[model samples]
Target: MPENVNYYHITPLVNDLERFFNKYRLLAVESKELGIKLETKDLATFKPFPNKIYVMGSLKLSRNRKAKGILIRKEGKPVLNYSVASLWEFERSPDRIERSKVIVDYTISPKEAIPKEYGNLFTDDFMLWEGFSGMGKGGGRPAVFEGKPLVLPSLIRITPDELEKEFLCRNLGGIWTPKHKASAENRITRLQTFGNTFFPMMSRQYFPISWGSWESFRLEGEKYPALEDAVEPNV
Candidate 1:
């Protein structure tokens, strides 16, 4: 019998957003195989989870940076769900140092990558991630807007002094201190989520199988789900 080795690369794209999400799904399955459970419920109603996980972010390589894949935390342990190299390769155990580096790089300057509509809302260093609920201690503010609740699936950057004011003025879904800023930000930077003040958010969606299930897995592997193969691939 021959070894089952697979090659991976980012896929070409006609639709950018569609491809990015496809990569996200692949990463989710890889996370599952690593024993990291998918959090399906709203993250707002419970005590804060100890890990600040980022489901998607840009990866910096020697040549250039590519916007794709990220690390997710489960039960207080960091798991390298997917990376640029994950499109074709599967690792039983990713290196701890690489995992730490991915988490750190995930929080770097994401200003340019932010959506145009969300521009005026944030002007400081920020990190974007899904599954954010502004409840619990140090979990930011309650996600309320115009007497209604909002679903926060993204993370933003702010300052400690501006925390209270931002929540009130920007109608932020919630505002709170980042428990691990000293390490994640390496400075006094606060994190926030989208609210309905400037660009209102839609209610959260409930998925029966969650966003990324092994039900979508393939045996031969996939191309990087990027619009371009220039950076890296993880489809």
Candidate 2:
């Protein structure tokens, strides 16, 4: 019942620019958990989803090295939701051979209580996760931030990138592309009540989908409802 689990991420930023980021960690505080690292590489080239986050520039961790995936949004959606852990077959799947990283909690990195006096109003780099079973070592009990709770470190790392070309072709709120022209699906029908994986992504020749009853389970589980706990924690 111990497959190395620890995850926690909270970056509430907005102004004060946290000194333009130069290394600010508050993870695990001293080892109760919060040790995330796994970027083994290759998850079928790319195209695996659950919210979404994949890119590489600087978060500190390099093993196989070949990273160049980028996805982020706010007025668009996505806050770090992509999952893989051998779909709960868990013997050890920090995404079990790639898809690993952890480093976030930049003392509330620009989460905005009212800061933005200048730049960084759309994304100064973001990442946060307390899921994918971040509190693994057992189950239930870990979930504390700003008061000191352990178990949190599956992976967290992101900083400084060219992420301002309009956050480049977003895909979290539905129909960012795949050529989604949106003649009038009502913005994909108001983004299907908070994104039901945008329902088969509307047939995806880019877009042409149609839905109704149960939105067809909205991309129903194969391992992505925030990863259903990337499995393996009977600890």
Candidate 3:
């Protein structure tokens, strides 16, 4: 038998994403062999899905927004990419007129820093959060905030130099990168100013499994306890 295999599921709700990532992180810890890919479904269909993940539906955050993402798999112990996991938050604009729409609190897992029996699958690639109805990075998605739209480089490839420069701007909230509307030279200044507060910066650590009742944001859910045993290997 080979070693890796991947399966795909469209995560239409925040709770589902939280649950999947919890499972993904646990499997990584135990060095289990399994693969799962979660693609963000169009926000339009979110309400129909079971389990009202958040009460912000009235906020209309999904009315015109959509997110996208990948594919793969192997056999035996599948070679899963830790990059598949991410933590997102919806920041309410200080003005209340324009919500941040999406804020990626954490993307890289902290465990990757320590030596592990299995190994690490961490990467610096930033998660893509497009706007303008998915037409391009800058458009009217859900709601256009006061500042320039949140955009980043193509997830497919990011140069080493860019990664290094972006790292310098990491802050408390988390991060997203590769500047869309700004020049490479002005990247740091622009990012340090708005990026820190907006996207924050993707941090290295496991995000909380549950988000208590927080009315300011839409991403919230009950705790998804870890599995007692290694998940069944990808069949």
Candidate 4:
């Protein structure tokens, strides 16, 4: 197995906020079972998880190069209020080199999540295809390919600084993170699941299952349970 495969993350389709939160809760529970803790926080207040996974919630970006705030929940609904200096802090931090992070954004409702103004900076069809193809063992397909190249809002191991300077600034046209590439290749080559039970169940899901190498096989069977069996019951 290749190195640097130490985290697995699933960024839900954000067309429906309620569904997004529901999926987040389920992912958190599954991560916990694998001895990994995932947290949702504003970029400014973000802290390293130290061998764990951190899922970023909605990030409000402005044209002024400063983050307006983050999306949070109140009264069982989504709200945006948490403030941040800049998304670049992810790279400035000393611990970032050793830490693994995945940006959990969604492609659903692109207008609402990623506006046209920032399209050049965030949209990348080739990278999205590469990542998904690698994750699903060559069976995954891009979700937002509307007659054009697909766009993946979620990214792994890429800091805002690199994103702006290397990818966006240079007009690179796609993600250039080496760790993400390595992780994708590693997963495609090493990660394997058996039995038609989990395979068919996973195939029926609407969302893609993009995970990192940090995840353990012990949780594989439980990770992608059938929808009917996976949904949590109302209290």
Best by TM-score: 3
**Local distance difference test, per candidate?**
0.22, 0.21, 0.24, 0.24
Could you list the CA RMSD of all candidates, in the order they appear? Answer: 19.9, 20.8, 18.2, 20.0
Each candidate structure's TM-score, on Cα atoms with residue i matched to residue i, is 0.20, 0.17, 0.22, 0.22
lDDT of 1 by residue, 1-235 (tens): 0112111211111112211212121121122222322221201111111242223332222343333322221222222122211111112233311111111111112212222211011101111111111211111122222234332223222333545543343333453443432321122233333442311211111111111111122221221122222221222
lDDT of 2: 0.21
Count of backbone clashes, every candidate in sequence: 9, 26, 13, 7
Which of the predicted structures, 2 or 3, would earn the higher lDDT when compared with the native?
3
Worst 10 residues of 2 by lDDT: 205-214
Off by over 4 Å in 4: 1-97, 110-144, 158-164, 167-224, 231-235
Candidate 2 wrong stretches, greater than 4 Å: 1-114, 117-144, 153-235
Candidate with more favorable, higher TM-score: 2 or 3 = 3
User: lDDT winner among the candidates?
Assistant: 3
Q: Where is model 1 more than 4 Å wrong at Cα?
A: 1-56, 59-67, 71-153, 159-161, 166-209, 213-235
Q: How far off is residue 49 in model 2, in Å?
A: 25
Off by over 4 Å in 3: 1-5, 8-45, 48-51, 55-77, 85-235
Ranking by TM-score: 3, 4, 1, 2
Give the Cα error of residue 110 in candidate 4, in Å: 10
Error of 1 at 38 (Å): 20
Candidate 2 local lDDT, 1-235, one digit each (tens): 1122212212211111222222222111111122222232312122123233321231121343322121111122112222211110111223322121122221222211212221111111211122211222212221222244322212222221312221223554533332334332211211111132111111111111111111111133322112222211121
Q: Model 4 Cα displacement at 46 (Å)? A: 26
Lowest lDDT 10-residue stretch of candidate 4 = 196-205
